[model samples]
Target: MHFKLPNKYLKYGYLLALVPIFFLVRYYQSHDPEVNTGESFFPSCIFHSLTGYHCPGCGSQRAIHDLLNGRILAALKHNLLFIILTVVLGIKGYYYISKAFFKREVVDWTYNKYFSITVFVLIICYWILRNIATPPFCHLAP
Candidate 1:
């Protein structure tokens, strides 16, 4: 039984869904998520709240908010890893969308063992660096 998804739906549907996301990011760019001011509605990091330490995603919300507002330096100050990952994932999305438009298989994203391992290691390193209290790594904390 070979049941395949219709190309017409997959292609246009993704583009339609992206419209709200585009507006959402733009809205965040202007409306201010207010992540750092202690007045933000966003939930606190459970890992941080319980362990009293920074987690890999501690400042990602603030980083995204800053990034959307074109504050590159401030975004990096909040969470460099999130910015990097955003760019990487954005490129991946571009690839998938292009393929979808051409009516190709969407699962064409190949998994590379080495690349996955490297990303995992980098994320772990960032998690550890953000927790360090020293001068060099201290800036990584949110």
Candidate 2:
């Protein structure tokens, strides 16, 4: 049995594209700053700074760093949405890459109107829920 690159350009291009992601994860791993720190090592979220509230993306940078450092619970504590999005996107990327490079027939993901609306509502709810500093909802804040 033998395997070969799908195409010369694609093979090199795919590997080259990964370099930046690799470096980004590496950077995060090295600079794992806590989300609630006064002296933030990572770039601050402008929305959070002006509003004194956690934006939908407030803790995503710290979440990524925690995830890279093998702190799954801490990562989730920072931003559950980022973790969920990463998993969803990883699955999609895997399917597309396998289809393109291995000649595998990957099933297409269908976009349904109801599903789209549900996701949109869920995100809005999550945003609102995290901002609520009461009971279980308070735990959602980073």
Candidate 3:
């Protein structure tokens, strides 16, 4: 007489829960005029309200928004690294989910020391270049 949920069902349930949250966030964004909720949320972007220097994740929101709105060029203009990272993360997430739910292993890339070092190097390089470079490279803020 006890109800037990399967792993797939739980994963889908979590996804469903996200739907209402997304709608609510969209509604709030649409309704609030003064609340700069998008790329502006990050204080490090050149276009944002922050007075100091730029942060590495500054233009990410605008990038995501532009990408979602079918403006690939504009999204790239905002933050190329952010967009690329998003795509990579999305692919990784899909692979992980499929493997977890369907018991099907798509790829056999192991996360080892080399992988960690590569990711760390990439992030550090991105951080240094974005902060020290000129306007356009600085534009890669997010």
Model 1 over residues 1-142: C-alpha lDDT tens digits?
A: 9988897876678779989999877766765555356654667789998999999898888788898778999999988899898988987876776676665655534357887888999999999988999999999997
Instruction: Give the clashing pairs for model 3.
Output: 44-55, 59-142
Model 1 alpha-carbon miss at residue 12, Å: 2.2
> Cα miss at 123, model 2 (Å)?
1.6
**lDDT (tens digit, per residue) of candidate 2 on 1-142:** 7966567677789889999989877878887676445554577879789988888787888888888889999989999888888887887888878887788987756345876788688788899999998989988888
Model 3 Cα lDDT, one tens digit per residue, 72-114: 8987876777876887788787887788777887973535788
Q: Which candidate should be chosen as best, given lDDT against the real structure?
A: 2
lDDT of each: 0.81, 0.82, 0.67
Task: Tell me how far the alpha carbon of residue 31 in candidate 2 is from the true structure, in angstroms, after superposition.
Answer: 1.0
The residue pairs that clash in candidate 1, if any, are none
Whole-model lDDT, model 2: 0.82
Between prediction 1 and prediction 2, the one with superior lDDT is 2
What does each candidate score in C-alpha RMSD?
Answer: 3.4, 5.8, 5.2
Pick by TM-score: which candidate is best?
A: 2
Candidate 1 runs further than 4 Å off: 1-3, 35-41, 102-110
Error of 1 at 128 (Å): 1.0
